[model samples]
Target: MAAPTAWIVAAAPLAAALSALAAAFVTGFDQRSAMPPDLAARFYGFFLDRYPLFAFAIPYGVARLLAVALAPGRSGALRRVIGAALGLGLLLGLSLHPTFGGMVLRAGFGTGSGAFLNGTPMAAAYAFGAAAAAGLFGSALGLGAALIGRPGTPRPGSRRRRAGRAILHALAGFLALWFAAALIGLAHDAGFGPWPRRPLDARDAAIAAGLLTAGALPHLLLVAARLRRATRAA
Candidate 1:
């Protein structure tokens, strides 16, 4: 029982690392246009099309691996710190976007420069401060989760644990398949650049969906773990 469970636990991280590596490849393959607005459009397009979804999965996948890797040794303080840090990082990212430059939907060169450049020095300072705070917070959350969750070790299994593992493994498999399909779609090159098309290509849409699925994996894993534990204890 221990050996097999251990293998599953080990596999979780392997999966996450592989997924992260995949994300890097996807980002690299989808080159952004050179112009600032075009770049911004590509950046925003990545996020809008499906990148945000994929982004969340990454954190989720990494978190799951971390949970297994850090378990037993982890403490309560660490969990709190991690929660805090994630919360803060989220906050900082949001706050910085506005002050760094007023949120202009960047189009193309000379497309909307005025909107893009509408931040005062004071605004910049505030934005920077917010970013710093967020970083500190995210750091705290990571530390706290590490300490408290005792992340690496799998808890003793009962019927509930088994069921939970089954669900998670299923989820992981699904995500992996989804990612593979997305990669295929991306490879098709529905349209490399951000020039608007009358109708977005199917391959591009699939890629977007795949990216989102990747991003959401982390949160899904967290929830599954918690629920599994709860069911086991009950």
Candidate 2:
């Protein structure tokens, strides 16, 4: 069931790109109705701009490429591509939800642009927070590998187990912060948080929270399952 060709890699990424673009278009259409047409267009354009993509592309591309590259069989690549497309779409859609200090990671957070992730502690908190959420987006590609097979040769030794468990816990905690970031957006949408920040309407925050949360469920469950399995094997 091994993939012997290189084109599969290109195909998977091409499909995911198309899906992500399509998702952006769909969300942009919704934004038109959600806000004034001009603002919606500005945000939509920003969503796809090179700057934001620049922030996310390097790490995400490396992770996604690895997932497709490692997929076992012909069908395994296809199955993972299906998940890749969906994951890419969900990540793009979630990025549209405005929050604070999220930087270009989720542009339109504290300011209109990314502004990198340095400077103030608030900005760094958001940078780390968004990276955490993006961590799930990056790593979740591995979950698609599961469709190809089950866990193999449990890495032997307590050290490996501890490290794996630690990584999972960190990702889980980061994802929780991602959710907390969403809540912060929700609060602002409800007219409570920092003033003059980029605004996400109540509907915007609610919808984004629900959709991103649903998207995160698989990553969360994957972590829980791994933890449980590791515990049992110990």
For model 1, give the RMSD to the true fold.
15.3
Q: Write the per-residue lDDT of candidate 1 for residues 1-234, one digit (tens) a residue.
A: 233343444345435644653554454533342447744553444333421222333344345435443443334655545654665454334322432211211111112233336553643433333333323323333343433453333456798977797567545544443343233223225343231222234454455445445533543454445535543444
lDDT (tens digit, per residue) of candidate 2 on 1-234: 212222343234433433443444345433235676655444554333322222223333334434443643345555555656665444444443452112234433433123444454665555554554455444444343333332222435788776886577656645643553334333333433221123333454344434434433444454345434543553
TM-score of predicted structure 2: 0.32
* Candidate 1 error regions (>4 Å): 1-82, 86-203, 214-226
Say which candidate scores most in lDDT: 2
CA lDDT of each candidate?
0.40, 0.41
Error in Å for residue 52 of model 2? 3.9
Per-structure clash totals for the candidates: 38, 1
Please, what is the TM-score per model? 0.27, 0.32
TM-score of 1: 0.27
